[model samples]
Target: MSLFYLLAVILIASAIFTITQKSPVYSVVGLLVNFLALAALYFTLNAEFLGVIQIVIYSGAILMLFVFVIALLSSGVGPFRAGPNRLPRIAAPALLTTLVAFGFLIFGIAQRPFGPLPPHRPTSFLGNVGDPNVFGSVGDFGVALFTVQLLPFEVTAFILMVAVIGVVLIAGDAVPQPTLGRHRPQKRAAEREPILKAPAP
Candidate 1:
């Protein structure tokens, strides 16, 4: 229980830190910390598969992709220009959507108020629906992911792909055409030069 509370605090703090930072690199670091804390929270909930996914997929892969994109955009090859503020125009609609979602969340919580925690069960309990040995085992999670949550899973992948592309489109305009063209031939020639000069075996 205490551990859960600690993890929750860490999660909240890291989330706030992630959003409030001015620097994108700092924000990414904070988000990485948030992901770690959320994974710890999943483990405390006995969802090992979720915890692992949170770490491996979100932290290891997606977050690293974000870092890589930031690094690529920040490379001194071109000036980083700020894009138009799309958020200001969408603020009203976004606020309304958030409020509606919050209302629904509150209604659901009221419908099933959390009661006291049940007595601790033994570690050997095989009470999951699909898997008998563990509640959040990889097999059970895979079955649920494919059978029940496939749409959301695919949507998530699509969203990530779109986000990466959008980031590139937004910031990729900074690179001058002449610089890119010059670098490409140099890089290609450098690649071939080493091979061309190699002694025949």
Candidate 2:
């Protein structure tokens, strides 16, 4: 088998393990491994920028968040109960739909005409910087991001900030209060007597 196919199988296996693992910590680690495998796949596809982003954003930031959340909630052990049931009620219909979708996708792929692969041209960034004449460069991406996609990026940042705030609020301790029917005792001079007093002649 080709290396690509081997990596794809490993990626799929890791993803399955990630979902099936009972422990949240192990699941997060599996997800991290899956992300790294995806990054490798992206590198194989010649998408270096996307691969780096996958490693930095998904593997680094998001996985760290998951780890932190697991550490905060877990007590170094699995839960007694595995929580509520997640099985779908209409399993038969869901399975039939999935099979039909897979069949249609395979039929579409089979119907595609095969042709000789086109030759690849080297991509250059420095040569096209600030050209305004050619496209497909780092400058073009920067321009698009700042001008066209600025609002979406801003919204995403706001959403992340709100999520962080929500997590913090949920993890914070509740306000302390006196026990039921209990009152604070008043302080008196006698009650406040010093433990050590100087002896007088």
Q: Give me the displacement of residue 61 in model 1, in angstroms.
A: 1.1
Misplaced by over 4 Å in model 1 are 76-80, 86-96, 113-128, 131-133, 143-201
Candidate 1 lDDT tens digits, 75-152: 844456768988879989988998999999999988986666545532422234475445577777777777777888
lDDT of each: 0.80, 0.74
Where does candidate 2 clash, by residue pair? none
Residue 192, candidate 1: C-alpha displacement in angstroms = 31
Q: Which stretches of candidate 2 lie over 4 Å from their true place?
A: 75-83, 88-97, 121-201
Quote each prediction's TM-score: 0.62, 0.56
- What is the Å distance of residue 170 in model 2 from its true position? 12
Output the TM-score of candidate 2.
Answer: 0.56
